[model samples]
Target: MRDLDALDRRLIELLSREPRIGVLECSRRLGVARGTVQARLDRLQARGVIRGFGPDIDPAALGYTVTAFATLEIRQGRGRDVRAHLARIPEVLEMHTITGAGDMLCRIVARSNSDLQRVIDRVVDFDGIVRTSTVIALENPIPYRVLPLVTQDGKGLATPRDAARPQGEG
Candidate 1:
């Protein structure tokens, strides 16, 4: 990933606060030329720094209220096949190859505790999956975010475009 400068950070912050705002509106708010904003957005996208501009969805709001993390123990030399099988399951939201007692960890969701058991059964039913231990999430006091990373100061470094940003925009 390219090192984000002050201008990039501010642009991200502004867009995150108002995702529906247009590039021209962003240019006006940031006090930079429209082309500058357009160029920066293009560069950021090309560099894969900006993934996508899509609506964030809450699974719980969509009838999946129960959330659990499952740690799986796999049979030797079956990681690839197991991961492929897991990819087909929509309830498997995220997966990571982990160290320690488990070979992989998966974040899963379901409608209820009983529903979670069914999900778990489907996960372990696959060949090469030995065992799984799961922990139900009671609540989430802090959700996932990347804003602090975007807004971090890079030891006083600022891009030329940062000069055009309004005071307190940082």
Candidate 2:
């Protein structure tokens, strides 16, 4: 995607803060025309920058209090099969191919420690999976966030628009 301009940055920041805010409200808050705000949103979506506006849900709130990451070693020539197997299990939140000792990594959740073992057992039940290693998360000191990355330049400094704004203003 193309680089985000000052207006784009500000608009994204505003939207990220108040996802339920209406387009007219966004225009008023960002000091832009409603049409401009809509057009920017359209372009951002078309460019795949804004993936979705779905509500963010915590697995813990759903009674799946246990969170763990599993690194899987798949059999040769079974990557696709292993992915399909993982996808069939609802507990597998996400999986990714990584460049490391393991072939794939998965983020999973469970109701408890014993439930996690059951999830792991199901994960490795597929013949395509060779072995698995998992680690449980004790506490999430810093949850997932992307606002900082959105305002960061390639050199790890804040963009001019973000820098000009005073701290805690956005």
Candidate 3:
């Protein structure tokens, strides 16, 4: 993974703000040639910097309002089975193996508090799971974001870009 130059940062900032913008529009906004914009986008995608342009869906809008985190302890050598079991449950949004008192942590969502219990039951129903603990999220003051990180200069400051030069030159 190479470092993102000034034009790359500016291009990313522009796309993050307007994901639906076409390459021509992006080139106009970024003051670069259309081919330049397309090339940069292609390179970013090829390098796996831009994962996908999928719609950002809200679970709350889909009637899954409640969110909770579950810390699970699985039986020895049952990690694969436990992971497969959790993956079959639709409520399991994401899971990670962490270094802590628990073996795995999962982010889950449900329709309500009562529905949360059912989700948790299904999560722990597998024979591979040994113990589990869960905590309900009351509020999310700061939702997920990556724009700041994307444009930062490694010193926690947004990098400045010079638009006059050709794109991807610097």
Top model number, TM-score: 2
The 10 consecutive residues of candidate 3 with the worst lDDT sum are 161-170
Candidate 1 error regions (>4 Å): 155-170
Preferred candidate (TM-score higher): 1 or 2: 2
Work out the TM-score per prediction: 0.87, 0.91, 0.88
Clashing pairs in 3: none
lDDT of 3 by residue, 1-170 (tens): 15787788888888876888888999998899999989988998999898888788899999999999999999999999999999999999999999889999999999999999999999999999999999999998767777667666766765564334233332
Q: What is the C-alpha lDDT of each candidate?
A: 0.87, 0.89, 0.87
Q: In candidate 2, which residue ranges exceed 4 Å CA deviation?
A: 159-170
lDDT head-to-head 1 vs 2, winner: 2
Backbone clash count, each prediction separately: 0, 0, 0
Measured over all alpha carbons after superposition, the RMSD of each candidate to the real structure, in angstroms, is: 5.1, 2.8, 5.8
Model 2, 1-170: lDDT tens digits are 15787788778888888889999999998888999999999999999888878898999999999999999999999999999999999999999999899999999999999999999999999999988999999998767777767777656798787788666543
CA shift at 25, candidate 1, in angstroms? 0.8
